[model samples]
Every structure is written in structure tokens, then in C-alpha cells.
Target: MKKSGLISVVAFIVSVIVTASSLFTASGDPFPGPVMIAICIILPIIGLLAALISNKGALKFIGFTGNLLILLLSVVVPAVSTLFWNQP
Candidate 1:
């Protein structure tokens, strides 16, 4: 995979670990939850974009735009969810 792909993958894995850790534990810890939510929402979309850009031709642009849409939707949908989730 390319650099961007590698970054996206790492970001995604980190996001997952953060999410699991955050979920199992209670609030009032040193770290914040929104940041983790942001990571989880953004990284896979980034990975998709990176993979699309690396493609030879044809649907590269389309794939990027599609991923962007996914990104936007992911952000919008989860923005509220994390807020409620982190709270009791």
C-alpha cells in the first residue's frame, strides 16, 4: 500500500482501539471522547480516498467523491451519537 493507505490503516486501527477502550471505561478520564469519534469517522473514508487515488484510471475521481460523501455522512451521523454515548 502507499503512504496515504498506510496512514489511513493505522489511523483506523488506532481509532478502533480508542473506541473500545473508551467504551469499556467510564468518563472523567484524562483523555476525551470526541477526538476518538472524529478519528473513527474520518480514517476509513481517508483510506477509501487513498485507495481510489492510487487506482490507474477510470473511476478514480468518482471513488474519491463517493468516499467524500461517505465521510460527510459519517461525520454528520456520528456527531450527536458520541455526545450522548459518552454521557451517562
Candidate 2:
């Protein structure tokens, strides 16, 4: 694979891992939640953009998949959790 493709793949992998870890690591503290949310959103965007700009088909697929997973982890999962698990 080319350098750009490799970068895209790396970005996709790293973003997914970081986003997922942040989501799972969330605590009751107000500060960490927002910070994790920001990390979850930003990293996926970077991965998605990197994927969109790539010239390789496989890399694009990997990137988009990672972005979608991140979206679910960062947005949908939290919303569901809040709907069902909010402790207040």
C-alpha cells in the first residue's frame, strides 16, 4: 500500500481504538465525560476525512467502517445509555 493509504488505515484504527476506549472509560465526573465526548467526535472525523481523501478502495472502506463504528460508540451508544441508564 501507498503511504497515504497506510496513513488512512492507521488513522482509522487509532481513531476507533481511542474513541472506544474513551467511551468505555467514562466516569461520573462531569469533566471527563465531555472530554471523552470531544475525543470520540474529533478522532473519527479525522479518520473519516483521511479516508475520504484517500485514493485506495480498501483504505476508504476501512476508514468509513471505523468512522461508523466511532459514530455508534460516540453518539448512539451514549444516547441509548442516557435513555436507559441515567442515574439522576
What is the C-alpha lDDT profile of model 1 across 5-66, one tens digit per residue?
Answer: 44544555555565556557866322566665566566657656675556444344444454
Residue range with the least summed lDDT across 10 consecutive positions in model 1: 55-64
Question: Which lDDT tens digits does candidate 2 get at residues 1-88?
Answer: 3555566667667666665565466563234666656657776777677777778687788877878777787678878898898577
Question: Which pairs, if any, clash in model 2?
Answer: none
Q: Positional deviation of 57 in candidate 2, in angstroms?
A: 1.8
Candidate 2: regions farther than 4 A off: 1-4, 20-35, 80-88
The clash count of every prediction, one per candidate, is 0, 0
lDDT of 1 at 46: 69
Best by lDDT: 2
As a TM-score, model 2 comes out at 0.61
lDDT of 2 at 31: 40
Best by TM-score: 2
Given candidate 1, what's the lDDT at residue 53? 51
